[model samples]
Target chain A: METPTYNTAFAELEELVAQIEDKDIQLDTLAEKVKRAKELIKYCEEKLRGIERDIEEVG
Target chain B: MPTPKKLSELVNEIDATIRNRFVGQAFWIKAEITDVKKQPDKRWCFLKFIEKDRNLITTEMGGVFWSNSYNQMENFEAATRQQFASGLEITCLVKVVFHKRFGMRLEVMEIDFAYEVGKLENERKQILERLVKEGIAVNPEGSSRYYTQNNTLEMPMVFERIALIASANTDGYRDFRKVIENNKYGYHFSVTDFSTQIQGDAASALIVERLHSIYKLKEQFDIVVIVRGGGSDTDFKSFNDFELAKAVALFPVPILTGIGHDRNTSITDLMARQHKTPTEVATFVIDYNGDFENAVMQLHDRILVTSERLIDRARRSLDTYKRIIASSSPETIMNRGFAIIRSNGKIVVDAKDIAVGAEIETIMKQDTILSTVTQKQDNGNTNI
Candidate 1:
């Protein structure tokens, strides 16, 4: 069985993106989402960097 | 050489009754042992027997597995022990020979060992180890690192996704499930098992090739799991190759291995982010995220604490401003308003500070009237 701990920020970011695209979001909410999105972006960037380094080592 | 008693002469003397020497090479003949002996001569083992058939055929034949071929014989027996049983059906490669002293002999060469299942497993392990040491990252899950200008290490936490590189349908699925799904912590993870022979001839190449395939999907995964289930001691040989270890050290996602066997550590284990005894790398990940949760919770608490502190500070600042407004009574200004007059564009602090003919004016909030600075007041005057 999957645990709630398995949900990464990516899932949250995807949700935010969906809300923006599908719902009428308030400007204040948009600002908060943007801030959260920046944090998620940072998380993704770190994940990708780790992958690159691993690929390089394997090579 | 004088023949002691020629079989043909003996038969003719008896009655010339034997027409032919063809004893009908009948192999279905049953025999009961009257005596069994190992001859002093190392070359052959002799058996004395009483034949039971249509006619009384009492005979003994020497049986031999030559010392030169004895090694092959022993190995063959060892391999086929699982299938070899008494009272079993028999089909062997054999030849019949006649000796001057002994009447007849049966020579058997090849014996079947029921099935060649294990033989195939071992050969596959050899190939897997060879491919790994060659410097190709056969197991796509391995550790990696990056650096920033501040010399701070940015270690991104990779979540529970690992591409397990192993043959599907083997013990891969079973072990992975036991570790990830059925654990007390209930760690969740997915395994994309690549089914191939775990051992024997084709195992090595298949494992390495699949490792390459998973490695290509680095962007899609956080880690890689190289796993196989418990088996013989030698079953772990596949992971011992240098190329495999090097591949693990260099994989895109950190490589985690749970090869199952507890023999000497393989090269892959040394190079991996973590090495486990089985596919329960999920347990490790769960605990890792457990720490992460504690950290986030602490952050949440600190935010609450800091907010309280900030609100307290703002309240104190607001109170200081309120006190200043309350103490500033206009009586201070009204005392000066009666004594001073406005002349031209300036306030006349005293009559001496103003000159005659200056168009002075008395001012109050109600009215501004023209006047003359006719008097001066003393330094300590309490005027009426």
Candidate 2:
């Protein structure tokens, strides 16, 4: 399975930030955005410190 | 075959003839030294002087430095601050001598330290010139398309998967791992070490091969990092190889180099994002992701602040509307000593609207007074 690229994760985070910053966002949408933001932050932070280390050999 | 002299006799004759030709002559010869071995007594230095054709070794000859000449070589290295080690290109004054036992060997007499430095400088210049000509060197003006190929790649905000090129047993690789693995922010780096020769003649080809492998799996890596621990200038020659530099320049993914030379920059450095050391490269990756994390944190704060301000504004608006509604309410007006009159289930706003002898009701804040209209008055003077 393919993992999300950093760029994709970061772009989603940026969009969430934008939505949260909007003054007219609906409460429901705001909640959704905040939840997504939390998820992205957690995912990114975990990736940054995750203990999964894999080293592959190639020609 | 019968006329051929004995092997030893021919060898002796050949050795004597070669000696007679160069016995008393001494001149400077330039070549790269390898397989260096210093005697335990420190009285002699034995090495091979090699000539290369491109990346391949063309010729090699054994050479020796006697105690006196070895002492001179040490002084030369000290004065120049360049180590006399394997892979060093040196121009040294030597006597061409052929020994019956050792065959052809150059006897070191004097070392030309300046010439060695010049040779290195010249090689660096040539590499730089070629890189510029090939349009692979960095040009701030964006005049060269090839130079911008790897540099212009959009760097990922977070560094998750890294394609690392280094020797497995090197301190550079270890330092890189230590820095990333123990980062304070707990940033995880999915690093894959493509172990390869980091120095010497085959270093360039090995590194290029690893890069090709990574390129094939470019989707798995965000960037390619070429790092090494500190080394002598001679060891860094591989980093300056034209082929390796070209490969780095043309790589699909962005390349980051940390070859660990404080004084000199290699051609590969010009073609890729250069860092001073392996640890610094690791720090760069961490910091890049940290910036994104910080932005997320800042956004979280902004959301809190802006939402609070919005809620406060909404509450104030609701309070103002509530006050307006209360002030205009009929009950509140009636409580303030005003009366409402109704006639036949209809509000009678004017005295003329009610006929004489009509029944009417007066409404107050908490009571209803039933009464009959005895007279209807429309003028200033009224009798009830």
Candidate 3:
């Protein structure tokens, strides 16, 4: 699968957070979702604050 | 070389002939105004009436508006909402006037306001028709509102790579750059300038060429922005050209136009994804990125709050379980003044369970005592 964009990753993270807050969620599923949510959060954070993104004038 | 004639003699003959032919009769003539020179003190103007065929001047005539006709010019400007200067097409009443020394010219009298307006509107309508025929624009359900393919494209959440199409060193470009470069959020953009003439007859073609150039490097830019500072309607005329509008409408990358005009959205503006002032476009880009950043920050706060809540709840449950286990321990019961007795490795709960002279071990919180039962007596009440 292709890597998710910042927007896509953020959207997924939000869904996982909603599931984590549900009282009836299965513990095993909750654990899996939490792990994926952490990865997504890290991806979005790096995209927003990455120093490697630089400006270059092509013309 | 025909017998030595005075220069005035021949000039007078020509003037007499012209005056006799026109007889001071005002004739309605159609022409484009050019080289208009207005004299504020005299309240009159000098102009040239020209006829063009395919961009080449075919016929030209000197014309004049005397002081008495100044009001007519003002009225025409007011009615048409157009400046009565060079490049204006009009049908005006003029009388042939010949002066011995000044030669011959047309003296302007009245202008047809409707003719001027109708001509401009007709041209615009024709271009719009051609665009529709070419399938470049869609007027859904035959309604007044229409959109082109470029207009239907979705703009990105934030634009980081910019292809700026503008005239070099113009205030619009400078203003746009200033806002983007100094955005409060410090968003960095990679801007490439594709400068071209943005006004005059050749502007549309020049702009079209620049669009093609940007197409070659389309991957380098997220959007193309066409910007120019405010100018007279004539200066913005090129933006209405069919060729330029078609190019903009067919462009693969989204185009944003901010060629300033108080009224009348140009065809190029219609084909673009969005249109606004240069400063406004800059603000929009900055604000879009700001919105995303705000959302991310909010999400981060929510994650923190939720995790803390979950952890606190789990910690409370653990604390309850620890209390239950600690309170049920034998040491805790012994501290409450209870003892345990075992005989033959079994708990002695009743007198029949233990025989006469049976040995037993008594356990208390702090000591173990050894004892033997001499006789067994069963009592209904085993109260201590």
For model 3, name the residue pairs that clash.
Answer: none
**Cα RMSDs of all predictions?**
19.3, 14.2, 11.0
Q: Residue-wise lDDT of candidate 3 within B165-264, one digit each (tens)?
A: 9888887888789999999998999989999888777899999999999999988888999988754434556887999999999998889888865567
> lDDT tens string, model 1, B121-168?
354455444544454434344433211111121334635666767656
Candidate 3 ranges with C-alpha deviation above 4 Å: A1-59, B1-5, B13-25, B32-60, B64-90, B107-116, B231-233, B339-384
Individual DockQ of the candidates? 0.02, 0.02, 0.03
Window of ten residues with lowest summed lDDT in model 3 chain B: B317-326
For every model shown, what is its TM-score relative to the native structure? Answer: 0.45, 0.69, 0.69
* Each prediction's number of clashing residue pairs: 30, 5, 0
The DockQ of predicted model 3 stands at 0.03
Docking quality class, candidate 2? incorrect
User: Each model's C-alpha lDDT?
Assistant: 0.51, 0.77, 0.78
True contacts kept of each: 0.00, 0.00, 0.00
lDDT of 2 by residue, B150-219 (tens): 8678888778999999998788999988998999998778899899988767889999999989988999
Docking class of 3: incorrect
TM-score of chain A of each: 0.72, 0.73, 0.79
